[model samples]
Target: MPGLAASVNTPFYQQHWQQIHLPLLKQRQTELWVCHLQCRVPAIAGNKWLKLKYHIQHIQQYEKTGILTFGGAFSNHLAAVAAAGKAFGFQTHAIVRHDGAVLNPTLAACQEQDMQLSFVSPQQYRQRQQSGYLATLQQQFPDWLLVPEGGTSPLGVKGVAELQLNNTPAGAADLICCATGSGGTVAGLALGHPQTAVLGINVVKDPSLPEQITALAPHQHNWQLAADCSGLRYGQFDAATLQLCLQLSQQDLPLEPVYTGKALQTLLAALREGHIKTGQRLVFFHTGGLQGLDGMLQRQRITQEQYQQIKSAELRLWHQFG
Candidate 1:
């Protein structure tokens, strides 16, 4: 398999899933493992680095000036790209979707990384997929490589397919799961692990997600999408989801509610509802968005106490490998 070059500097780590919070996991005899791709730059941790890996390579290979992408003001994708641009020596720009350009922690980090920001209204943002708008962007920034929002391009899927998540210390997983946003990661997983079942716990309530995944990994039929248990909108989490994130932190698996926590909550709901088979090995990809905690706290979505609790868990988890 073509893997990420050594220079990207992402180290892989696996942690056996341990959380008594979900009692059904024990009753079902399901072995769960969590895998992380730890990047020194932090924002590129988890699926971010893998998804952006090839995009960066394309820029370098083709001699493109930098990366031009689209995202919301608090988007993890934008943060990752900005950090990547700074760490890897490239310029970065983002077409941000928002009625007002508030300097949230995520956008602030992008600026700190020297990423240029251009705010667009939600109506204008909706035109991102239109060919006319894309052509205009191409004409405006001729030297820049325009990446899709959430990094779900063909090259992004190619990069994500290089991840080896089926292997655990115990054995190979019968099923693999991840928090699916733009479908690239799940699609890539299906392409990479054709023998295993891939489940995407969709954080958004988009009925078109399965079709999106299908479009990305057209040759593979090993993947499916499941709705989030809370049925919350993208970037929104309920109180129960917040509590679950705090509870899981006790097991040293830090997760943000918008993606990872919500997805795992849905997965646990499935296991408890008898949707998952017993005696099967499952591996969950921890798609990191810990950087979003600062934004969550700033937006008052999570209390300062909750933020400290979850952030501490992340600190301890990383220190173990240090």
Candidate 2:
């Protein structure tokens, strides 16, 4: 309850853009509205807070000591759980997929939040979803609530469903879009706004994701998934996507390349390809993971100039809204 209370008090803002110089959107006569969820704990911004808040409430209700979760070395989910734990007074532990010998900026941030980390081989990490493996984890950490990777469980979906993304400044959005990694956010949107269509740009190549989303919101049929346009691996992004993120930042929208940028790129591509129809309002949830830019910079996935450009935009937006 303390965690939920703390997060509920944080300010949230929405920025709508209809004047971008994109010919595709103009030709389609579509408007894009972005909901930027600002959290007191920066890492828990955007969908992270929406996904994790109910999990924290559940642990508190059941009198659990803390949370034990799984993620890759630079996972935004892990960073979010760590920050939420620190902000709300819960112990945190993570089973991380091994990426390299050293800690990246994301992992370093997790440690700063006092999140206990245990690295595992990729093969072992894949077993996280198995019932037997989950049983073992429960036996090992009996007092901690075991949250699914990316917080994609029912509780996570429930938390995300509380968002009112359909109600834009002008009117209700005809379509709601988000970058779907684990499917929880899109599922929540579909469940929350049964009248509006929800399109999730699948950032990962996992074939089972659609099925996973269906399982999460079985009665909801208003949602669909589209593959990422880049055709690159989940963590790997192309230069064009990076360029789009930079361009949008100048318009006062700070987007990171991994999820938000790739999603907007795919959405714009859909508009160009005539997949999205004309004269509709679209609300894209800027599910924040801008902190991952630091990890990207540390791994040389982005240049110093690119990092500074994005960071400067983020600082400006935060100064105005945060």
Provide TM-scores for the models: 0.94, 0.94
Deviation (Å) of 75 in candidate 2: 0.3
Over 1-322, each residue of candidate 2 has an lDDT whose tens digit, in order, gives 2444445434432433333456667788888777777776778888998788778888877889999999998899999999888878889999999976498899999999999999999999999899999998999999999999999999999988888876677888888899999999999989999999999999987899989999999999999999999999999999999999999888778889899999999998998888999898888888988988998998898999989999998888777763
Highest TM-score among the candidates is held by which one?
2
Worst 10 residues of 2 by lDDT: 11-20
The deviation in Å at residue 277 for candidate 1 is 1.0
Off by over 4 Å in 2: 1-21
Whole-model lDDT values for every prediction: 0.85, 0.87
Tens-digit lDDT track of model 1 for 1-322: 1233336534433333332335677789987788877676677888888889888888878888899999988899999999888877888999999857479999999999999999988999999989999999999999999999999989999988988876687788888999988899999999999999999988866677788888889889889888899987898889889888999998788988999999888888888888998988888898898899999999888999999999999988888767
